[model samples]
Target: MPIYNKLVRDRIPEVIEKTGKKFHATVLSQDVYIEELKKKSFEELEEYIAAETGAEALEELADMFEILHAFAAVHGSTIQGVEKIRKEKEQKRGGFNERIFLVDVED
Candidate 1:
């Protein structure tokens, strides 16, 4: 049996069982669940970076968004609240539409 210590989607065990193979898994505590979700966010971001096709990239991006929603819920907030914060930051600092790259700032 292969070892997998990473977090997985909710239906992973069910999917594995459907393959006629037995797998072991544990339910994480609330604290551990939040930590795992944070890790999963990074994993999904890397996947989005490596995606080649538009559809694949969009899928990965969606996965990251889902994780974000989970994080928001864990923190007693909603996705809409998160988006409001983001919009506020964008309004104040601006978004990436400029694509400006700052190499150095010395005076």
Candidate 2:
């Protein structure tokens, strides 16, 4: 059996069981869960970057979306709350829609 020491989605164990595969998993402590979430986010981001097709990119983005929701819940907030903050920041500064790149800023 291949060893996977990383975090997985909640239903992964059930999925594996359906394939008659025995696996080992443990519930992470609060601190460890948070750390794993951060790590998972990076993993998902890397997958997204490597996606060659639009559908594959979308699938990876959905995984990242799920991770974001889990992160919000762990921090005692909802996706709506995070969106609100995002909107506020967008209104104050701006968004990436312009595709502007800053090469240098001299004093």
Instruction: Estimate the TM-score of every prediction.
Output: 0.89, 0.97
Which ranges in model 1 have alpha carbons more than 4 Å from their true place? Answer: none
In TM-score terms, which candidate is top?
2
lDDT of 2 by residue, 40-87 (tens): 999999999999999999999999999999999999999999999999
Each candidate: what lDDT? 0.94, 0.96
**Candidate 2 collision pairs:** none
RMSD of each: 1.4, 0.7
| Model 2 backbone overlap count | 0
Off by over 4 Å in 2: none
Tens-place lDDT per residue, model 1, 12-82, is: 99999999999889999999999999899999999999999999999999999889889999999999999
Q: What would the C-alpha RMSD of candidate 2 be, to one decimal place?
A: 0.7
Model 2 earns a TM-score of 0.97
- The RMSD (Cα, Å) of candidate 1 is 1.4
